[model samples]
Target: MQQLLAVAIRDILPNKVRLAITRLCFFFNAICSKVLDPVKFDDLENEAVIILCQLEMYFPPAFFDIMVHLIVHLVREIKCCGPVYLRWMYPVERYMKILKGYTKNLHRPEASIVERYIAEEAVEFCSEYIKKAKPVGLPESRHDDRVGGKGSRGLHVITPSVEDLLQAHLYVLNNSNEVLPYIVQHQHLVKQSNPKMSKNWVLKNHNKTFSDWFKDKIFADENVSETLRKLAHGPKRNVITWQGYDINKYSFYTKPMLTVNSKHIR
Candidate 1:
């Protein structure tokens, strides 16, 4: 019931973009999701061009909005900016709703908001000083032990963490395709180091940390390593270079034309 209400409110909101632009954004998001390496730049560019073409096709005849012009330069914007979220207002707007809820009194709304905010901050500060007190504004069930229990429908599967991936043998077996021959040679090296170790034991223990212990270990190319290193660090910032309108460009000056037949007009 709660989820349905939330969905209805979200759908009914006046914040929606045009259907064509929404579809284009969805495609762009799909491309971004699969970008694990720098090699996917060509694919990203192609998707961006498709979106620009879509914007041109679905452009309204009467409206010459700034957003439409921005859509045309989406590719350049993405190149300058990191991702869509950084440039999007959805998160900011959602937070604004929370801020709006802070207002209580009609006569002195600003004072009420400030008072509520200070009270919240004081409670949070007090929670830190109190022994074993749950953090203010957090639900009592937030850290409940029964969260992922048998009857609970919560997600229970635990994927390997970054530290685990750096130290796990199973990760190497699954991702060894990138450096297959090197992995095989590394297995031999592991065996030499611990001849009595069982295959299961070796598989669970061999990792990048173990590789570092070996004097001669197979490593990825410096460029590939650097690219992977950057991927691990994640996007830095959401900076976009706003494209300026060229006065001479056909799209900038020309308005969509509508023709009426004389016989139909009469």
Candidate 2:
């Protein structure tokens, strides 16, 4: 709840108030996350006290209940025992609720629970030998394929416009680390030729002409890396577009999918 609220709150709240909320959420989230280290928990425990003080300044006195105080002790309790989910009462409460449902007769509730439980146990035991039986599990989601950035999908080839192709090819070169030296060298040449040019003017000149300049440079030099040589030649005008591309464990959709409500992307 705090995590979700923090994002929306940042847009609306004053700077100090937003910082308070963001820090509070981080402290709570860090405490509950799976791995526990005493050293980190100790730091979080200290931060918890500061967060409560921040909350106290913003919230009314009535808000400081025993429940709120328990936030500080959470880290200590986890250190003494294990993770909260392993020891919480929620699981026990759920089982008790299930047992209550087996009581069809109010007058003989205990007998009903015992009889139902034994029958359930017997059925489970017998079902183990049934070869055709399938274990019930979570159903497959339709968006499963759209979940990663492994590669491009739904490839459609098109001859892109010259201006768009040049811009895209320039963007690729600008971002690629291997091409950084060539970029710096080209920028130096642009600056040297136009000695009085402003930095922005030099950048504009570089972006406009660097593709051809780099291609010529690559052709003249024989010692350059193959990667740089391929980049110098530039991407084909006939490029492949994707409806979906999976990268960094996320599926991204092209703009056309957004307009038509893509089934693979939510």
Candidate 3:
């Protein structure tokens, strides 16, 4: 399939679209091998068609518009047995990530719409899981002037609720299915590293209350969020850091993904 796309892309006029065509072919090839059958091919084909149509819109004179529409229709011909076959395990998110990378690389005129659409779709997908899971009740505001700071009112310092935990869990699960196994294997490290810090530390040591700890430890940590974002993109290798932290490089779970690298490539 990749070879076929590589050849077809060569014929696409406008060097930028041609390059995008080539990369997208490779991206699809990587994803198609993993998706559940039947629905997988059709959805992937449809996605490819959408991208091609975007390209055609940019370069209509190349007759790529007809090719784009034909490809879109071909997607309907592929038959699948189950709905799961249509649903992507991680490919949808990964595809959007790749599109972002591709658009950045190409610097094309019409790529922003495609990039924005893909990113928005990814967020929508994440929101679905958020809706399904309960929110983790992390502290939002502090109360004491000494601990909470100037003019704060909220009384109790709340910790991340179950929803926040679940959101983090599902985000990791859907994005890097492989990381689960690794996380499971090293759950000990995660438990130690992510020990539920006491509110006292935030109040006395940091001059803030438990509420501050909740917000700072869970929600306000930019590094942790960035790490989650990376994990959401793809399966990453669990690189053991020198700091004696043997946690899953991507997720903070006890189990790791089942053949994380292979599952990702497939």
Candidate 4:
């Protein structure tokens, strides 16, 4: 609608309903920002008042309730207090949502909420001293902060096959910094030896023999990280697999879990 009305509506004050909403949205975003300018507090409040006025033009009188009127005061609060994030309703609303979910006794909602809140707080406090216990909600893996992350939940240990172990070992070696120069040296020599070999063949050949070559070549030197030395030594057959993983704010699931979720959706 904004695109359609773009040519017809020239004034900054939105004539179209959708344009008014867009204007309000932009204004709302500016006020909600973490680092708001105190100098622009008046302008921000004025802008909000204008947006609310514009909204009144588009919406009904009933829509201009107390909640809608509250938008006009947000900038003043920010000016007196600090950033909106520090004083936002989001945390309280989310906590209230959790409390609402605790309503087993619908008639005695206050009682239920108080009881659950106390129990939850008690559990949270006790959890700190309860070593090796899974948390009541959102269980954290001790390995979550480990190098390269250790998945959020449902980690299973298994013994992998020799081929799998070899592939895993070579993969680690290929990506190692200390061993990279050796790999380049090996690749150069391989290329010199087999001039007719394709780039793919060179890579394949390098991968096939680089592990054993590096193990021998690197043992003479003892300056690399213990991790690099271990990678050179090769992985054992045993492995730990994750059903779900959280790495760098991204969540990954195993194929079976994905399949099950898809089936359930279908």
Of the two candidates 1 and 2, the one with more favorable lDDT, higher being better, is 2
Which runs of model 4 end up more than 4 angstroms from their true locations?
Answer: 1-15, 90-166, 175-178, 188-202, 215-266
Error of 4 at 64 (Å): 2.1
Task: Rank candidates by lDDT, best first.
Answer: 2, 4, 1, 3
Question: Which candidate gets the maximum TM-score versus the true structure?
Answer: 4
lDDT of each: 0.53, 0.83, 0.49, 0.76
Model 3 TM-score on a 0 to 1 scale = 0.22
Q: Please, what are the lDDT tens digits per residue for candidate 1 over residues 144-185?
A: 443331212222334545555444443443364555555666
Order the numbered candidates by TM-score, best leading: 4, 2, 1, 3
lDDT of 1 at 156: 30
Decide which is better by TM-score, 3 or 4: 4
lDDT of 2 by residue, 1-266 (tens): 76797888977888877887899888767766777677787788889889889888887899889999998898888888887666779789999999999999899999999999999999988877773555579465345546434446677888979998899999999999988888999999999999998999999999999999989989899999899989989888787667777665566876545556644543
Query: Candidate 4 at 136: error in angstroms?
Result: 21
Q: For each candidate, what TM-score against the reference?
A: 0.35, 0.46, 0.22, 0.50
Error of 1 at 85 (Å): 3.7
Which pairs clash (backbone N, Cα, C closer than 3 Å) in model 2?
148-246, 149-246, 149-247, 150-246
Stronger candidate by TM-score (1 vs 4): 4
* RMSD in order of candidates: 26.0, 9.2, 26.0, 9.4
Best by lDDT: 2
